[model samples]
Target: MNAEVRVNAVFSDHMVLQREATIPVWGTGLDGMVVKLQFHGKQTEAVVANGCWRADLPAEKAGGPYELIIEAGNQLIVFRDVLIGDVWLAGGQSNMQWSLAQTDHAQAEIVDSHIPDFRFYDVPRVSYEDGIVHSPSWKVCTPEHAGAFSAVAYYFAKGIITELGIPIGIIGCNWGGTSIACWVSEQVLTHDDDLRIYADEYNEQIENFDWDVFAAKEAHYKEQIAEYDRRFAAGLREKELGDFPAAPMNPHYFLRPFGLYSTMLLTVVPFALKGVLFYQGESDAHRPLIYDKLLTAMISHWRTIWHHSMLPFLFVQLPAFGNGGNANGKEWPLLRESQLIVTEQVPYTGMVVALDCGDLEDIHPTNKKPVGERLALLALERVYEQPVESSGPVYKDYLIDHNKIILHFDHTGNGLEARGNQLIGFEIADETNEYVSAQAVIEGATVEVWSDQIVNPLAVRYGWANYTEANLVNSFGLPAGPFRTKREERQ
Candidate 1:
């Protein structure tokens, strides 16, 4: 007899299925065998073709502690404690991967994190297609396992479950220090002119890839990493620890463009999802000019693969960071502009403003509770159709009235207000294209910006730097993100 039928590893005990959506149960099985799936008083079947089969169960309402049974050729697989609810995929870089145990107030959060309905599934961090890896399983929210869950995802789910009282499943699909290029498909990257550069660079890097050479380098890298870990555990300061080890850029390298798309993302495709929560872009900030187009293409490609034309994609706007060096550089500001552009142009998408939640010196800020809760607010307002103020004041348009510029804004819940006594981070530029600090005052629903030095102010910008102390916010306490009226010539 051929091998027994197997359901995808994503389907396991304590798993939460997307409620009110067709739940696709898929796996590999013997060729020409019949596979059947039964759940919630519904039955579906598909014949195995090319060693694969899929049976989609009918949608159900948001309540379940049911069992899922699959049978193929006398082989039976049963998964218990399955819940029907909204499922979300959390995708991004280090901030999204930062575990709950490493976040602020972790001990208290973990102690209170015993919501049985909320669950998490961490996709294994596989870099290469042929790399042997263990299958990941779902974990119920408990003090023991919640500590290891993504802090951002945890808080987001907690907020949702608190309000809606429904099971919320989060599929953690993220890696630290990875560019958006690593998560998108090769076909999509190669098809675009600007994006082709990533593919070209990747091809060049792996053209002479050698397993033997890679093995030797990896051994050395591991040793160095071990020593670094020892020193870090020994309480050495980060600056005193010296440079961290860099892995060899071989074919199996994790940072290789399109590598995670094949190894990590593909493994979770077609899985039912309410939407995607993205928090990346730090690695791609150096090339801010192309980030908007790159992110738009990535969202479209992901939606296509999941077969959801208007799949909701809510992403975090890159937060304030000084990069441990220059805090005034325009690269980060430009990247934030690109992110805002994507939200403006793309439909069924939202962005969470984290300007106030960022750290001035640390790239990885410890205050993730606000970031995750803000994301939950967006999902509630945009996706779940809840009555919530999800965003702060966003710049709408501007008018030049002689020496002063009148700026309008939207989403100013109630009205916009400077968090402190006075507004800061506002600058005006004359025809000379030189920006100087300007005085801004909230005027009813709009803000008036002016500088005595510039009689003919041609442009205005707010919080236009890699790191800023912008105090503008709405009555709800959400901060307005950085913005500029026009593209700077130097940028």
Candidate 2:
């Protein structure tokens, strides 16, 4: 007799199955035992193939709290407290991983999580040797369970729950201090020459480091322990900061990019989900130019592996943070532009504009409900198709007329309105290419721009800064995205 029954541990009570799509239910059983799955008025059955049986259950329309019963051999696994609705994968670094406990209304939110149906299944972080991952099942959302879930995912789901009234399942797979490259596949990194150079250099660093030599260095210091201890205690606060290069060059800091992705994403994460909600880029803010290619590769790699085209892949745009120069603050204008480029190139992709919600001092913004809520708004309208539009006003195009530059925007449902009474950050340029403060006034549905200094304006920009208090908003109450027209304003 062989022990034969395994369901990915992530599937548990209160899991939300995808509505209106082929649902795959699999587990191990007797070599040829017939597995029966009965859910939502459909009974599907399949024979155990190589001791693993998978039943493709017919699609169910968006609605449930229904039961899912699986029977095989002498074992019967019954999943209670289930629901049918939208499920999305929320992934990224600390921002995406930030817990509800860290948010503003955590106490109230956690207590309220005991609500009937919303669910989130968290997968443990584990790295692997291959590109394919098989992770465990999920945990339903409850007050006790909600304490540890991601705040970004939770708020996003809350917005969906209030609007859709259907159970929402969030698959959270995030890690703090993670890089975009680490989520990309090895093949993509190897294929691109620019990225390959970084990979080769990284592997070389790991290859050349001698751990024995490192140990010897530590051992050598052990002999002079008394002196070392005196120096460490007396006035060596600098050493406490940690040294990057111990033996002329650091070993751990130089590991290959995506080396961890191959190790973790493939080994620990499961591939089935409606789509991905990604928020990363703080690590690569310095290389804002390369950030585009890095993210594009990461998204493309995952989509190829999952075999889903036009998967509703959404991401949070980089929010404002740092005091001034760190992460190339002013340079971020270009990076945000690069993100727009990816959205332009890729279909079924949307960006959650967080430029307005950033806190200047702290890198991690505390007001997270809005961030999660905004992303959910996009998902609901675009992915769930709820009865509402989901976006701040977006810049569409512009017109140059004499000393005035007329701006046009998209999805200005009912028209544009400033959050405050006045517009604060619009800039216009003269033939000299010099930018001067431009005045903005709503002319019916478009914004008319002009500046005293820019008597012959050629281009214009709005709220395009590392820190700003732009009041531009659409009738939807969503702010307008930072934007600029590309003609040589002064030249």
Candidate 3:
């Protein structure tokens, strides 16, 4: 009598299941075996077919500490301290994975992080074709573990907890410096003409990779890391260590299409989720032209996989970085502009402007508190029907009159105001398409921009450069994101 029944490793003792959703509890059992699941005083059963079985538990409200029991003939499994609440998937690059210990005010935040309703599940960094090879189960949020947990996720969950008072589960599946291509499937890449190049390039790179050279590069990177640690120990902030050195190539691990997705995302599928908090785009800055398309494609594809076409996607727009001597010298600003396009064009999507939180020297900003809370504001307002402002002023429409261009914006929380005495970072261009510094002033919720040099202003740009210290913001103290009012034909 082989009556052994096993559930996915994700089904841990302290897991938080999505509230008000049909819970899909699946596992593998012997052929023709009947598996029964009991939770919240209800029982459901399923017959094993082809070595797999699933029981759909009825939807539950946002309250729990209930025990779940699974039985199959002589085999039985019990899970305690189960929670029913909002479960959010946190995904992206290094910024999304930036732990609390790495951020500002970490010591105080971590010391106070003793919320029992908050749970975390960090996916092991590994890529596989089949599924998650090593599953690290859910952990109860504590002061000790919170220090290593994703700062953005922790703060975001904290904000939601303060408002909703419900258990929150943040599942982190992020890889530092990974591109959006690494998260999507190969089929998604090959299906799109513009994105197919990434797949093709990875295929060629993998085929021609030299393991010996890669090993040498890895060794060199290790030495650099050691030196960096030594410098940090000598009372120097890690941010002062300057740019992180690029590591050796791992085509199959971080470069291949759907590499991280196949291993990290696939194993967690069919698990009900409230939404996704994404903070990527730094790695894709170089490909700014097609970023909006790629981002929309990723969101659409992810929704399809999750079987929730209306899944809410909240993302952080890239912030100001290194100096751009001129408008054309940097790719980051263009990427920021493209991010705005995705936020506006894509349905059920939100973008949090992080222009004010950027560090001029270091790419990873330490002020993750605002970024997290703003994302929570979006979810609270749009998803939970809470009355709150989730965004700064967003450019809506522009009207050109004589030499002046008046720009109108939305989400003006308590009207707009310049951070300093005078509005800055405004530029105007003529028919020649050469932008020059422009005088700008806030007139109600609209900004009037003009330049004496450009008699017939053809286009107007605000905070359009890579590292302009823009001062325009709403009353909420949230900085207005970058915007360019140039028509494609003019460029």
Candidate 4:
């Protein structure tokens, strides 16, 4: 370890370099120092300027247990057990950050999770750049280590490996209870009228930020959390424990707009990758209408940073959740609609529907396997050119025929069918915009809906609630996502 020479924190032993792509190895060193990198008998060099050095190794095929040796003056660094393979970045909030040990069938999955070629690199969660203490290294998938990996990422990698037999590396870059605003750059937030509110509000809060006041509040909040944990471990009821303490807002707060982009995402930029897998939107449910714009801008910003204009971006639509009542809440359905809009408008992007995999009372669904596997299916079909049905039936168009509203959909794999005894969760709206429950029947590749109470149906919506037993599915058994038709009221 030489003080004058250092490698970027992202590279380490057991790391997987993206195969068949130019491998970039960068570091900092004394000015004018010549840094050299050697891997698989291929050598490259760069001169350090402004205390930074970068060397690009020629592309190699997927297969390695090789040593990467770097030499700068007298100091030498060697990273061993490196593999060349496909690498993907898993980015989003809580559902994407959920751990394997917390998911369903965790015990069995952990026991069987011994894939030497599969690896993970969890980006350390830090609110600010200065808060980063140490460089987190990559880990090989094993029974002992797999429990801590992101369950969605683990299952996704497993699915890809089973299909391609190539080494897979997943970089977990996510946080729990985070908004889409937290991941995008500040410049992106400031430019858009609808998105500027997030940045403006954060700036207002931090303008008068006082370190002493924030520290005191944080200390108290920590104490309250410890007490709540102790009571829960002692079998105390949640009602007796009272509500969880809220953290004080500050410049370093994790939820602050652009905080994670500076701290978490920037650390792994320019690292070659296969693509990205995102699972988010729960936090943005309150303002669902603007999500399509926010997400599209964020995707473009990320691709710009990575210098890959067509990077594959696959995401999960928010699953059904009661949000503490009967599953018929409204905000989440709107957010899911926004997600669908992004997938339709953005190129090289896909969305996975999780309408049938939600909990009535719990927000974090434990069935992450389906979510992850669906993402893999999208990658297989769109990225790898494999023949796979990656999506469920998606709303395409509607035909108003007298009193009935007929709905047409794309990706109706084999055809649509109700998952239960009868089709449920359909509603029809009249010219006055008054909506009532309607009966729906599957007809060929389309669904026909009508209600005796409404003669002229102006609009129709299905699975339009926070949570619903929307039993509509394709022949592939994949559930159709929430959707609504746009129609104008008669004057």
lDDT, each prediction? 0.91, 0.73, 0.85, 0.89
For residues 1-491, could you state the per-residue lDDT of candidate 4 as single tens digits? 34678888889999999998898888788999998889999999999999988888999999989999998888888999999999999999989999999999999999999999999999989887674358689999999899999999999999999999999999999998888899988889999988999998888878878899888988999999999889878867535655557677797789888989988898888899999999999888888888889999999999999999999999999998876554676788888988988988999998899888888766789999998998898899999999889878888899999899999998888899999899999999998887899999999789999999999899999998898998888888888998889722211
Clashing pairs in 1: none
Write one digit per residue (lDDT tens) for candidate 2, span 327-362: 224555656766776788888888888877777655
Task: Enumerate residue pairs that collide in model 3.
Answer: none
> Could you tell me which 10 consecutive residues in candidate 1 have the lowest summed lDDT?
235-244
Best by lDDT: 1
lDDT of 3 by residue, 1-491 (tens): 23378887679899999999999999787889889999999999999999888899999999989999998897788999999999999999988999999999999988999999999998778765544356478888898689988999999999999999999999898988888999899999999999998898778766768888888978999999888777767857534654456665566556457788787787788888999999999888878888888899999999999899899999999877763233234577888888888977999998888887877756788989988988898899888989888778888899999999999998887789998899998889988888899999999899999988989988887777666688888888878898888635212
Off by over 4 Å in 4: 219-245, 487-491
Give me the displacement of residue 224 in model 3, in angstroms: 7.9
Per-residue lDDT, model 4, residue 122, is 94
lDDT accuracy of residue 170 in candidate 3: 92
lDDT of 3: 0.85
- TM per candidate comes to 0.94, 0.81, 0.91, 0.94
When summed lDDT is taken over every stretch of 10 residues in candidate 3, the lowest stretch is 321-330
The collision pairs in model 4 are none
lDDT of 2: 0.73
